[model samples]
Target: MKFLASFLILTMLTITNSITAQNQNTATKTITVTVVNATSDTGKIGFALYTKDNFMRKPIQGKEGKIKNGKSTVVFENVPSGEYAITCYHDKNNNDRMDFSKNRMPLEDYGASNNVMAFAPPTFENAKFLLKDKNLELDIKF
Candidate 1:
């Protein structure tokens, strides 16, 4: 029956399209971030990936790596491909947070994406990056 044949072909095409879309949505992407100018041991350094809204998406582990005299790396595993911003600080005092001066100035050096920085507070847009299955290197100065 031609009707049955046409129906079967349409169903197969629909299923194929669905499978393609699912694969695209579920593919995992690896993003490697190499930090420079860090002064603390790798584990002591704090690194976090954030969404454009500034909410913490994930925290990077130092066990996977450690910052040398002034360098470190974090490989975000299986991250869904998307836009993200990186912020890292050396917790020299192990306070688990960046210490700021009484004037709200960052006592310890900090780095953001694209190194977007200013005398005033930096915005998330300054550090945005498009991740698409490739390694991105960023430099931070402390």
Candidate 2:
């Protein structure tokens, strides 16, 4: 009787652990970012995903995609439910960085997650979006 009870308890524990692990796996979701108005398909589009703590300083994730029909798309996978912002720039010269003029103005086209166009730099509050139970898609124009 003791052996049978121990086996049943172990089996229940294993099943419960497996269910918890599966739930955790399903909690993470994907985010799709699309740059809608790239000037040309000359070079790759660079995308950066930022959390509030590291907004505009260092991106937690980064991706690059080629432009097609004046649009570029990137997918960020396995993003847990939280607030995130995105910034993307058209690397028109294929230099892997946004170009800047001598006066410190950006030469390359750039955009934020909320399509914010401002004289000053974008902030986390202005560009942040919540990633909850479902996947998200954003269209930003530059």
Candidate 3:
């Protein structure tokens, strides 16, 4: 009967759509950023993910992680494959923000991708890393 055939087709389509959605979810990548030498484990670590176009201005994703054993790790899950940079700092004062001294020097410890910290502020080019289909682990030293 036409009714039976239509019902079967609809059920098959529903199953197919579900499988496609699950595949899409698994396709996105994950990045694990580990920050080392956090001054202390009292406050949390603030991290930011940046792209070339939005470097230092706006972070596409920002998060906070608890420090343990003098280190903190942040995981960015379900990320699309692209080039991105990372910046993180140990919020020693529990102020939920980075503190700067009168001379513009960082009051707390900070780290960037590739452990890059040169004369100038961290540039996107200096800290950029490739995120592919597979997972990534980056170790940064402050």
Candidate 4:
């Protein structure tokens, strides 16, 4: 029947559209961060990725990369499009946290996205960058 044929065609079209939308929504890209100028390549590099709500307190994601030839490269994959900030420090002692001096300044080398510096802690807005449906490359220096 013509009615049956039409119904079948419409159903197929709906299913195809749904699949396309899902693929679009799930598309993601990689964020590559290269940390350079490390004081030494003796320890692991600890890094964190932050969003507005989780800045400093909690990282949406965290990673550690081997320090190689006085440099390190970290990657965050499958990242959805949004605003983000990155912070990293050298864990020379392998204790997994940044060291501070008696004056409360950092004792270890550290860097952030945009290489932002502040008298106090830096804000997310100062270092935030947008990631769309494409790969991003960033470099931070210690």
TM-score of each model, in listed order = 0.73, 0.84, 0.79, 0.87
* Local accuracy of candidate 1 as per-residue lDDT tens digits, 1-142: 9999999999999999999998987787766666677765644667777777654444332223366867877776677777877777777777677789898888876776677678855566777788765555555554
Candidate lDDT values, in order: 0.69, 0.92, 0.88, 0.89
Order of all candidates by TM-score, from best down to worst?
4, 2, 3, 1
Off by over 4 Å in 4: 2-7
Task: Estimate, for each residue in 1-142, the C-alpha lDDT of model 3 and write its tens digit.
Answer: 9999999999999999999987875687888998978777989999999888998987988989999999899998878878999998899888988899899988888889988888567888889998866899988888
Give residue 94's error in model 3 in angstroms: 1.4
| TM-score of structure candidate 2 | 0.84
Q: Best TM-score goes to which candidate?
A: 4
lDDT of 3 at 112: 90
lDDT of 4 at 128: 94
- The best candidate in terms of lDDT: 2
Q: Which runs in model 1 stand beyond 4 Å of their true positions?
A: 1-10, 40-43, 55-65, 133-142
Error of 1 at 31 (Å): 1.9
Return the TM-score for candidate 4, rounded to 2 decimals.
0.87
Estimate the overall C-alpha local distance difference test score of candidate 3.
0.88
